[model samples]
Target: MIEIEGLSMDRDGVRVLDDVSLQIPDRSLTMLIGPNGAGKSTLLGLIARLLRPSAGHVRVDGLDVFRAASDAVARKLAILRQENHILPQLTVEELVGFGRYPHSRGRLAAEDRRQIADALHRANIAALAGRRLFELSGGQRQRAFLAMVLAQDTPYLLLDEPLNNLDPRQAISMMQVLRRAVTDLGKSIVMVVHDVNCASFYGDRIVAMNAGRLVAMGSPKDIVVPSTLRMIYGVDMSVHEVGGARIVQPFS
Candidate 1:
């Protein structure tokens, strides 16, 4: 479980997060949803230890994330930010291999090789392994990066708006891959999603944030109601159920 207590972030005297507290249960898929500038990404950075919170604490399974050693935290959690800048000349395989550095220490062993292969397969990018990042399309590059995160083989995974430039098919495929990771491998996946429909379909739990604070949290059915949607996005939306999954129709 991840426990966030009184989390607040400040930048240049501007408060981005305000006394935010959350508890993310283990082995569950939680989706964070909010409008722009709601501090979702800032909170994610704090949880991943990418940035130090000005106040509060983040504990991953009782281990203080900020106080823990870098290697120890890396072993337990993996994070993929939305904006990642990598060398354009690097091959997908080489990029994925970097994920093993916590364990391999720059020298990949047999286990690392196996993990790399598994991650490529899981992300459906096995054929793109040898291709240079610049040679691939936008969606393909996203898949390659996702493969790198998967190769980390951590129990907790945090992804920030991973569907940024993906096409519809690629987005669906990625969500399915995440579902497999949770159901088959028992991984805890927390992702920030812009598409309410995508979060409705894939998330076991939906957390809504607005103005740098958590506003609502529940199952999709509970959080996707008309009132909740209006409260969070300040827009009236229609809700539909198809094949037991809730979908939000924001544009009518």
Candidate 2:
């Protein structure tokens, strides 16, 4: 379980996160949704230990995130940020191999190779393994980054707006991949998403944040209602059930 107590962050004297306390359970796919500057990315960064919280403590499975060794934390959780900067000349295989650094240190053993292959297969990027990073399109690059995170083989995966560059087809595929990871592999996946419909469709639990605070959190059925949508986004929309799934239509 991931626990945050009195979580708050300050940047240049501006409060990015308020006194927020939330308990995110394990073995579930949690979607974080909010408007711009709602602290969604900041919250993910804090949970991943990329940014230190000014006045709170973050714990993953009872281990204090800041107090634990970096290696220990890396083994438990892996993050895929929005921006990635690496040697453009590196092949996809090489980039994926870096994910095993926490386990292989420098030299990849037999098990490391097997894991790399599995990650590549999981992300549907095996055929492009020999291609350089710059050779792939934006969506493919996103999948490569996801493959790298999967290669890390951590129990918790944190993704920040992973669907930004994806087309509709690629976006659906990515969501299915994450769903498989949660259902088949039992990995805990947390992601920040902008599309409310996608979040409503795929998330086991939807967490809505606004103005640096958590406005609502519940199952898809609970969060996809008209009142909840208005409360979180200040927008009026109609919700319809299609084959047992709730879909929000914002425009008439």
Name the candidate that leads on lDDT: 1
Candidate 2 is scored at a TM of 0.96
**Model 1 lDDT per residue over 1-252, tens place:** 999999998889998899999999988999999999999999899999999999999999888999999999999899999888999999999999999999899999999999999999988889989999999998889899999999999999999988887888888888998998999999999999989998998999999999889999999999998999999999999998989988888897
Worst 10 residues of 2 by lDDT: 164-173
What's model 2's overall lDDT? Answer: 0.91
- Any residue pairs clashing in model 1, and if so which? none
**RMSD per model, one decimal:** 1.0, 1.2
Q: Candidate 2: which stretches are off by over 4 Å?
A: none
Per-residue lDDT over 214-236 for candidate 2, one digit per residue giving the tens place of the 0 to 100 score: 99999999999999999988889
lDDT against the true structure, each candidate: 0.93, 0.91
